[model samples]
Structures are given as structure tokens and as C-alpha cells.
Target: MQQLLAPIYSFLQCETPDSWIEEAKKPEQLKGLLIDHCNCELKAAQTAMFLVRKYAIDKQSGQLLLDWAKPYENFVYIKNRDIGVFLSKGSKKNELSGELVARKDFAHSDDLIQKMVRLIKEEFHHFEQVLEIMHSRGIEYQNVRAGRYAKGMMKQVRTHEPATLIDKLIVGAFIEARSCERFAKLAPYLDDELKKFYISLLRSEARHYQDYLKLAQAISVTDIGDRVAHFAAVEAQLICSTDQDFKFHSGAPVLNVTA
Candidate 1:
């Protein structure tokens, strides 16, 4: 595991704060933590789906991606939260219905679709996995408002072509890296089942970060080292600074509500 995480550890400018981990380990916080985690998994899939649809695929193929996400969306946003119906509906399945065609004249289109589709598939599966854990634990899934971690990183995205896309990809990399780091940090404190699940996430999460970094580099005309460093600083601040709400990816807890 250390081998897989070595690069992730070096990539991020800071670790998840000890205060955040302390709040996360509390028994009372498990419900909210897992609920937010379930939401996070779905959001990760949607983000990848959005990237593929917006930048890489055709309109029809993009529609297909949206259609694929609909059932899961209904379950979360529509408050269905029916695991039975979701499985019966086959929304948990990972395979795409048809090949996704790239947009005309875009060199990186195929690569973006390839990486993002794979990411979307895995994320969807992870979402289902988290949902199952929640069900088993009797934790109800609900819409958790997104914390500032992502929005704060996204605020750094440039508004121009290629630069915007590249910045988004860099942000994706940092988010994935932080997820992997937090999973590692939090795993040991969880029970056997949750610990195994969190540890299982490390490999794919690490690869997701690398995938985003490679795509950003491939799409950019120039090196992205400085951009990566810039986001690294921003991401670190978001992690280490005081945050009001405590989600899975939230910053240091402002107060120990559990106390």
C-alpha cells in the first residue's frame, strides 16, 4: 500500500488535519461521514461523466452518458434511495451501452473519454458499494451540500481554452489524491468491514489522480508543473484551514461537536 501511496503522499502539499481525523473517528459521526461519502462517490462519477460529455463525446453519446446517470440521480436527488429498485433497475452496472465517439478535430478527445469513462465506471461502483454499507449500517442516504474543498479548488480554474480544461484536470488530480490520502489516514480507525473498503479504494483513487495529471499534461501545449504546484498550494490551504462543516473531505473541524 505504501508503494501505491508514495507518489500521492509526495503530490499533496499537506496531510488531512489531525483534527478532522479526530472528528471522523467518533461513533456519533459515522452516520454523517458515511452519508457524505455516499454522496461523494456519486459526485465523482458525475464529474467524470460531465467531463466526457462536455469536452470529449458527441451530442448523442453525451445523451447516453446522461441517461446512464439518471437512475442514480433519481435515487439521490429524487430521494428514492431504494437500493432494491436501483439494483433491479440495473443502474449499478458499469459497462457503457455503446461506444462513445469523440468530437471532430479534437486530438485529446479519445484519451479524455477513455480515462474519464473508466473513472466514471469505477466511481459508480464505489457509490453502490458505499450505499450498500450505509444500508447495512442503517444509515440513510441524503443530499449533503458540497463543502468548500472542491469549490475552493475550482475557483482557481482559468477561463480560457485548454487552460480551463487543464486547470480542471489538475483540480481533479488534487481531489483524487486527497481522497486517497484521507482514506489511508482514516482506514485504521474504522471497523473491519469499513477498513477493508477504504483500503480497497486506495489503488483506484491513486490511479485516478495519475490519470487526471496525465490527461492535463497531454492536453496542454506547455508543461503543467507550475499549474500543478499552484493548485497544490490552494488544495493544501483548503485541507489545513478551518472549515465549518464536517464532510468526508472537509477541512479541520471548527468545533468538536461530538464532544
Candidate 2:
């Protein structure tokens, strides 16, 4: 675990605040923490699915991606939060037809498709795992609003074609890296089962960050170091600053009150 976190610790500008950990270790915060975590997993899968559909696949294939996500989407949007129903629907295999070709100018579209599709699959599986945990604990799943962490970074995304794509990829890398870092930071404060689960997530999350960085570099026409550093700064500030809400990815807690 130390070996896995070493690079992520050096990559980020700050560690999660001790105050936040203190707040998170309380009993009242467990439900909110797990709820946001479950939502986060689905959102991660949805983000990866969107990238693959928009940049890599054809119209029909895009529809298939939507079909693949429909069950989870229904659970989130329609408030159908039953764990049994959600699991029973199951996930579809993410197979693509030969007709699903890359755009004319983007050279690494195929790579993006391959990597992002795999990411989507794993994220969905994580979503199910979190749901199972919640069910076992008798904690009902609820839709929680997103925190500032991702939106703040996304506000910096460039607006043009490949630049837009590249910026989003870089943002993806930061998000994944931050997730891995926080998982490591918070694991020791949690119960044994939850601690093990969070630690188990580190390997795949690390790989996801590396995959995003590699894709961003491969697709960029110029050096991405400056852009990466810029987003890293934005991510760091979001982590270190005071945040009103105490979420899984939120900053230092402003209030001592539990959720």
C-alpha cells in the first residue's frame, strides 16, 4: 500500500486534511460518505462512456453505450434505489462493431475507445460493489449533489476540438489520481471491511490515472506539462481550501456537525 501511494502522494500538492478525517470518522457521516461514493462510481463510468461515445464510436455504437448504462441511469434519475432490482438488470457487454470507426483527424481514437471502455466496465463494477456494501449496512442510497472538486477543474477545459478533448483527459487524470490519494488517506480511519475495500480500489484507480495521462499525451499536438501542472494546482486548491459540505472528495470541513 505504501508503494502504491508513494507516487500519488508526490504527484499531488497536498494530503487530505486531518480535520476532514476527524469529521469522516464519525458514525453519522458514514451514510453520506457511502452514498456519495456510490454516486461517484456511477458518475465516473458515465464520464468514460461519454468520452468513448463522443470521440471514438459511431451513432449505433453510441446508442449501445446508452443502453449499457440505462439501468444505472434509471436508478439514479427515477429514484429506483432498490439494490436487488438494480443488480438484477445487470450490465451489458461493451462490444463494438467494425463500423464504429474513429473520426478523420483524431489519430488515437482507437486507443481512447479501448481504454475508456475498460474503465467504464470497472467503474460500473465498483458501483455495484458499493451498492452491495450499502445494502449490507441497511443504509439507503440517495442521490447526492456533486461537490466542487470536479466542476472546478472542468471549468478550465479548453473549448476547441482536440484541445477540448485533451483538456478533459487531463482533468480525468487529476480526478483519478485524487481519488486514489484520498482512498489511501481515508482507509485507515474506516472499519476493517471498508478499509480493505478502499485499499483494494487503489490499483485500478492508479491504472486509470496513468491511462488518462498517456491518452492525453498521445493525442496532444504539443507538450502537456504546463497544462497538467495548471490543473494540478486547481485540484490542490480545491483539496486544501475550506468546503462547506463534507463529502468524499470535499476539502477541509468548515463545520464540526455531522451529515
How high is each candidate's TM-score? 0.95, 0.93
Among residues 3 or more apart in sequence or in different chains, the pairs in candidate 2 whose N, CA or C atoms overlap within 3 Å are none
Enumerate clash totals for all models, in the order shown.
0, 0
lDDT of each: 0.89, 0.86
- Top-lDDT candidate index: 1
Model 2 spans with C-alpha error above 4 angstroms: 89-101, 256-259
User: How much lDDT does candidate 1 score?
Assistant: 0.89
Displacement of residue 165 (Cα, Å) in model 2 is: 1.0
TM-score of 2: 0.93
Estimate the TM-score for candidate 1: 0.95
Alpha carbon RMSD to native, model 2: 2.6
Runs in model 1 lying further than 4 Å from the true structure: 88-92, 256-259
lDDT per residue, candidate 2, 16-97, as tens digits? 8888888888889999999999999999999998998888877787887888787778877875467777666655433333
- Model 2 lDDT-worst window of ten: 91-100
